[model samples]
Target: MADAATSPYLVLARKYRPRDFTTLVGQDAMVQTLGNAFKQNRIHHAFILTGVRGVGKTTTARILARAFNYEDASGPHPTLDLSVEGEHCRAIIEGRHVDVIEMDAASNTGINDIREIIDSVKYAPSSAPYKVYVIDEVHMLSTAAFNGLLKTLEEPPPYVKFIFATTEIRKVPVTILSRCMRFDLRRITPEIMTAYLQSILDQEAIAFEPEALAMIVRAGEGSARDNLSLLDQAIAHGNGMVSAETVRAMLGLGDRARIIDLFEQLMGGAIGEALDTMRQLYDLGADPQTLVADLCEFTHLVTRMKIVPAAADDVSLTPDERSRGAALAGRLSMRALTRAWQILFKGHEEVARAANGLQAAEMALIRLAYAADLPSPDDLIAKLANQPAPASGPPPAAPLARPSGGGGASALRLEPAPVFAADPAPAPPRAPAPPLAPAPPAARARVG
Candidate 1:
């Protein structure tokens, strides 16, 4: 046995990888279904596991392979309770088990590559109860390869069990998907992820501030592997004691309180203050794109709080976010929040492409600040509707007095003057008299 000091140091991600269903976090639903299936002896011959990266797709595939081949003193039976290492558990987990074959579809995507699997499916397990083939990134397989495996995959021998894992489930054909039991792994929520990380830190005897941990969790964005990897780097950077300042510095993140202040300034139409805050953050090593992304996230949070008041109580949110966010939500209209989100979201991309990220970020902030005072379309429409209508035309002409009639007493009554259409046509031109008319008149007078 190697000395403790001489043993190679493993990163937290691999060191804390879930070994069994009991240890897996944020996948209770899938685990429950599999457990029920195993309990009822209704195991499917093949299964396709799909999810985003770091959600344990490949891990679940391996776990399934182990369960299929699991055996102990009792007998050969597929089970989910992997508490006690079975006869072949160590070898399978170590990935050297002959009967449990693992293949990367990314590297071997050709039809010929799949032909090997087709040819080998007939062979029985050497030591384990079943021949388990685990193909990862199965969506990368060629169309011909998938077609070739269809018939066999649909109806494989009793001794053969197949497990496929892919991040892109849509890329897999419907025919292939129809033939296999599919399990969609979910992203780990922040609450569960936090508990899992805390447990690991406790076991490893590392100290971490809750705020620091929350920052890490936010950075992870609901991915277990990503969180673990970030945790590992954080530990090293913090010198075994994770602090919020160190993590913020490591991630190039602005101060949360300052970010909140900046958001408030932008939404309050204080462009100068917001730009100053932005410059300070930039000088402190905060990436402009990241800063804008953080603002966008805050905008989304405020929007959620406005829509669903319960969102403010989420475990992932800090005290500052809970209180300040609720206040912001109460004061700001949903339209304004949505508009801020749009501007910040677009600004993030602009910052990414700009020659000077800080300048781009400032420009985006200025736009948001100016837009803060602008009324939403709905509000503008409402304002227009509420205003009194303008005078349709010039006020009716002054009342006119009618001339007194033949009655003994004359009376005047108010009446509106007549109105005419604009631009009346001109009268037709008169014709000229002929000169011969004058000569006829003179002849009549002299000789008639």
Candidate 2:
């Protein structure tokens, strides 16, 4: 029988993996730092690139490998010579170089496998000027395997260099860490990752609405790879285009608009509307527990904006989101917002563990809604100060944080209202009174 393999689909994650520093997103600081080192010809003999999965640790290692073995079949590499179009650098990127060897430590974690690398140092490269060995997932190497590799790594030929990449840096031996320069790749920010995905969409001529892109980036959770993979799934589901509805369904996310709508209702103290929105989501076949988690994350994002306005700009939020978020911010007292967030997260745990997730989530949301009416600390302090002191209690101002400008809370830093002094009242003119007659006693006056 003929083999019936399914057609392969290249997910966005793999299809758009950064091929070079220029293509890399959200790692500008690390990229710039590395570029400076390269420009100065201060490259080290060994390097350890550490980061979470899909943040481009292995990719950075490959780039460094190309930087060392770079050449110009068509043009010179991007080294000091700078004569070439950087086209020759393409070969290294394509993994066609003879001198650059990539080893997957997860698959080949044995003393013998490490010994093979050690034995290769005696010979010069067949073509390239330098030989680079990239070991990925380096933390997986056995202790004996690491020891076997260490001896060769410490005293390799001048032309030989090592680049190790790992998601779990803590698991890597400290002795191995000390042998090489290290760079930690950050999780790509939502802003950078969204821009990256949009650029790819434009390149591929895929129609993606802005809201759809935002959803995709949010789903990515700071992993460029994960975002792309999700985009791929979304593209297939939507026939090469992405819309908010299709993406939400594919990701099993509740409609973001619905989520914001519910949040707005909750923030605005319209508990009825919020409950209706929840009912609508349930009717739409959304997993209630997932909805709760997504809402919690949404609240977290908005809360971050309180401390840093740049957070909203830096995150991937639809334009409608900005307006909605601002309105919610206005309605929610900071104290209540904090309490709601805590409750939502705690409820998420409860929902996850409960037999009926919907009930747990509903209860959690209702609790949040109920807590929304509570007054913030500022209002409470103001109320206490203006009210009469209890018969048995000390004064309210004694224990309160009484700012010099008493109208505004000290923590908020708002300027106090101007308090004007009254002009002194004109002295009342002295009133002249008739001299009092000597008053007789009441009984004598009555007798007279």
Candidate 3:
């Protein structure tokens, strides 16, 4: 009990770390290829894993390291069928294997550090068949360090296997990249992540709402490690039972239903209602920038549903989102949805930089609402072209009347102007009329 009290608890991310390729989620293609390579004994000397942080670049590299040198109790030969525990698995997993070396290129970015690797590559493994080198954040290596590794990386010893992991693959030199077998890990989809989180919670005997799990998945943004970390915090914050409200407050997320409602109001041109909703959300501790981002995401989802009807049935969307989004997709045109997207996207940026976030968000919503009501240029043009033309021919002339004053007086009558017909025909040629004399002074004065 005293030992347990002194030892710190492991976080979920580390405690449930994937032990083998079979346990890796959302990376089936890479796993399949590697599995085939191991079966065929066509393993590459140098391998590079690249992806966003928390997406398992480092984890995959470590798994590869263990697999490269794994030896089952039944046989000493290297094998990929590591379903059973291997002789070197524990040591490699604990980062204490003599044959498997894990290096942080972030701290060892100098040519001297890489020179050590180049010097050591000539030596064979002491225990395992292959000596594995795992370099994390390989892009952080300096130019000189990269240059030092280029020749060896391109042609390494038969007993050596180099594994590189990086979040920024672009920063890695082409020379180094050309020598390695690159595997790009993709972000885990929200559906898969949500299910994974639920499984973990169930295993821990912790109660959780599905909506709460969904919120955690969203907060993770497709990173499994990040999601697990958030889940750990949520479990603690919720006191063993995760609820939607607790998760929302923990992540500072706005209400998903209300955000959808706000979007609907904007699309319906309900500016007042949208503003009120935004205020209500803000008052409830939702960030203005986050709300705008949510609206943008909602707009994108609707656009997707519009283009691909199958997207309306995606499991990633909540029940409310699927129903509301389908209705919106059917109600709004591509042009209107696209315009709304642009407005919200730009407005998100404004809110991010505004002195008063709520004000900026409200202004953006107003812009979206007004823009929704306004017709596109093409629609406006079509409407104007379709309008009916006025009646053709001159208006009837007024009756001519004399003024009370009689000296050289002439009466003048005003006539309505002729209206043009839609696609009017040319009139026949007519004889010219004689010029009229100037009006008399008395008539002019009387008319005035």
Candidate 4:
């Protein structure tokens, strides 16, 4: 056996692939279920593993295969505690075990390819306790191939086990899906990915900055394999030291502080300054689409901070992001932040599709800046409701005639009618007017 020090270099992704259930991250539910099933001897003959790319669907399938054929001096029994490699573990993991067969449906998607599997099910295990078949990207199989697989897949020999992996679970027919015990592998969350990457760096004795790890986590987007691959590149790029500046340059990411500043300039309606900042970032190797996405992300962060102040305490955030984001959240209204998000969100797609991404990004920033100055619908409604109604001239004075039998004419002044605003205020309580004097009988008769 070759020692790691003397062997050719292995990529971090391959070097650190999880060898057993215990090492797998962000899949505790599936791991527990499998453990319970194996303990009870209730393991199914056919198991389907489904998840997005890089989330470990194929890796899970391989692990399942290893579990099925696990053997030791105690006895030949299935188990999930693969902490120690069993009799055939090394061969199986190396994909050289005669009893453990691996197939890629992507390259071989036809009835003939599946026919071989159907024919092989009748045979017994060559050495291991169980004959395990691992098929990857199973959704790529042709319709006829799937139909051919249906009968054999439903009822394989007691000594045989089938494990299928697919990225597109929907593409796999319901008939195929219904016949198997399905385990949906979840994407590794950022928190878990961050820890996992740090652990790997520690084992490799590589130095890494926390902010650099955060960038890698963001880029990974919950994919373990992707995160590891990125970590490898960052380690190489930084000459064994992963720094935030190096990761930013490697990923074409803008500085977090500068990104926050850009957000401020846009929200402050400083279009010229924002545009200048964006161009400078682009010249520094930042991607326009990535920059727009950063704006959208910051908008989301500020919005979250506004609604949930506790979000500002997240460890993934840089000190600048936390302080400035919290301040912006306090200063900016929810409506402004939401509107900025919308503009930037739409503009991200435009930048991706545009012939010139920088120009498209500039236009998006301009639109966002101009839109920030426009009052929200609610603001407009409040303003309209608060305005004073139009003033009218003073009410005309009219004569109040005296009774025919009495003295001279009296003048009565009428106040103008009350002017109501768009949203009128509640009327004030009124005191009863004094009773008017009644006209004399002769005055009433003459007026009539």
Candidate 5:
């Protein structure tokens, strides 16, 4: 179906596209490098910016274009005014400037197109001092087009500048690349992506739980554009408040709440309950790989809690998730949690790549359930050392805690568990008082 109102909402992606060098995310190395070069007036005549899809390659090009074409009343050009915003900057953004031209080489791949560009370069800009030719997907230009433009590219008019951008730098010939200064834009990091998304959500007056924002960040992979696209849908899909539940449904993720329950059952060695939870999720149309992935994140949160208990207060968790996580942490040991994480991660890979992902997932869950009951290598060794040789009738319900020569375990105990009715570690029985004959006799005499 077509969109309800095409023009009503400008997505967080396009709406918040970086307007200047400072706004670019997770490209600090490139931004600082370019900023320093511009300050030193060491910029080259031709340049290339390379990166993956939606990683701000074109945006960077636009920023460079404005920087090069920019001129102040003092007549220094972008060399003096590097800011990519203003009245003239708006024109540059809208692609209306006489000097700044943006070409999509994908559609205009031919010799004549190159010739037309070549012809225009001989004459300097009619208005702006530098004529910037931004060819997007420059790798798409035909052999003839590249050949035709080679001479001008090697040595264009003093005022003509070329800025090429490509998703695949390997496609462009070495001869073409050697003439330009190249900067490879990098994919944004999850932390940077999360912070940026939070800012956008805040400005929109949208209420989003931190975990929901992290989901969007992870979903983006590395592209600010992709994250914004997801954010757009998330904003529209929710009641203007993005929450974990909304993000999960939007991304086709398993319900985290249910996933957590399944995880708890796995930790507690309840295989039947874990499988039942999986079926319930499956009935709700949850993908197995997604469910595993959500579990991966849940494991990560628990691991974080292990490392820095205070991190439980981190914004990435919804309030309820934080509370639940605290409870889960309190109940489980770090070693067991880490082991579960490893098994689930491996299972996710197997399930994701399998022909029958659901079956793979079910099998994976069973494997995890088995892993939950098995002892770690360390524990296995300890048990073997202390095993009651060949027990006959119904082995003890649970193993006893180890102590040094009957002394209670203490050094390794970070925090003691709370007291309960059937607590396994009973308080050491109090020793009987020494025969109280002397003290008792004195007390009896005083009573008499």
Candidate 6:
């Protein structure tokens, strides 16, 4: 075994830090714009780099700083086309450059820090042609500090360049934002991240399963630094050979195959099987919330596949996933997939907050399973509308007995006679009926 002091292992994140924009992944738009800006001599005095954590905001800032004052055997003028590490590039990359000052606003977030930068801005560079200040987590600066910085930005010197990096751009005051060219760094896609990781592993002569690299990509969630850190941990966990099983164990992710099976069971209305699968996954160290979350993602993927059949060709999916997912996409209706997504989405939240997360997850799966067999609202309504109306009264009395020799269509039905009341004894002779009475003359004249 090598001595710890004699052989220090640099983690993949730091070992593979991008030296130039060309090496940066998943930031083509920003790189192209910056490259054009450099070529056209359109460099801004101040720039704000905004992105999520580990998405290369700070890395971009450092690269910009080096680019602004890069000096080599060729010349000392600023240029964006930095192919090789210039004289000042190494120092800046090492964070020890005299003219490139990297400040963590999280630690020094006060008016005094802003004032120090403001004071230093007037002076020309001592070593490099330009003096660059890279402030990270710039959103942590106080209001008064922002005001002070705004003043400096308003009248920056020709030799001064400001590079601000923040994870939360909304926290930064718009007044300061307006004075700087803002670049929004997008999250890296899984395909690009996986490819990049594979390339790194190849260069290091480290054997890695493609699935393992894919798992790292998903776990990284589009952050290059985060993905590299995860890759490092995975390599260590796998004893220097990254395998899918080792990566899965490290991430505590449920088996993708099992997840797909669970999804199928839920969609097929196999509540018992789905619940059993969930329990099995839990026993294997999968989180209940994570299970539901994965289910939700699977639901979304199925929906996409249903809409665009080409989605079945996604590279991230394992062979089993692709085959089973394609079958599922064909089997499920859009309505079913959407309903599953909604249930799983809500269940994910419930499991997260529930005291008994596993139980909640199981119940959520049961709901999805039962719901899968149910008719959608539109179908139910249409079914109801198509049903025949019930008769309002009892059936007519059976037809009177037909004559024995009656023809098939000539059956005779008898009608019962009406009955009249009968007096017990006849009255003495009936009284005579009265005659008509006489009328007045005017009545007669009117009759006439």
lDDT of all predictions? 0.90, 0.79, 0.88, 0.90, 0.82, 0.88
Sorted on TM-score, best first, the list reads: 1, 3, 6, 4, 2, 5
RMSD for each model, in Å, please? 11.3, 18.4, 11.9, 13.5, 21.7, 11.5
The superposed Cα distance between candidate 1 and the true structure at residue 151, in angstroms, equals 1.6
TM-score of each: 0.86, 0.76, 0.85, 0.84, 0.69, 0.84
Model 3 CA deviation exceeding 4 Å by range: 1-6, 391-448
lDDT of 1 at 402: 56
Error of 4 at 307 (Å): 3.5
| Residue 141 displacement in candidate 1 (angstroms) | 0.4
Residue-wise C-alpha lDDT for candidate 1, range 1-448, written one tens digit per residue: 5687899999887887777888888999999999999999999998999988898887787788888888899988889989998988889888899998999999999999999999998888888899998999999999999999999998899999989999999999999999999999998998999999999999999999998989999889888999999999999999999999999999999998899999999999999999889889988999999899899989999999999999986777888999999999999987888889989988989999999988898999999999999978888899999999879776745544556565543444556666887998888987976566455777878987
Model 6 C-alpha lDDT per residue in residues 372-419, reported as the tens digit of each score: 999889998999999998787544455666677767755556555555
Q: Identify the superior model by TM-score, candidate 1 or candidate 3.
A: 1
Score candidate 5 by lDDT.
0.82
In angstroms, how far off is 366's CA in candidate 5? 1.2
TM-score result, candidate 1: 0.86
Better of 2 and 5 by TM-score: 2
lDDT of 4 by residue, 151-229 (tens): 8888788898889999999999999999999999898877788889989999999998999998899888889889999
Give me the displacement of residue 334 in model 4, in angstroms: 2.5
lDDT of candidate 5 over 229-296, digit per residue (tens): 99889988996889878888888887667878888888878989988999889888788898888888
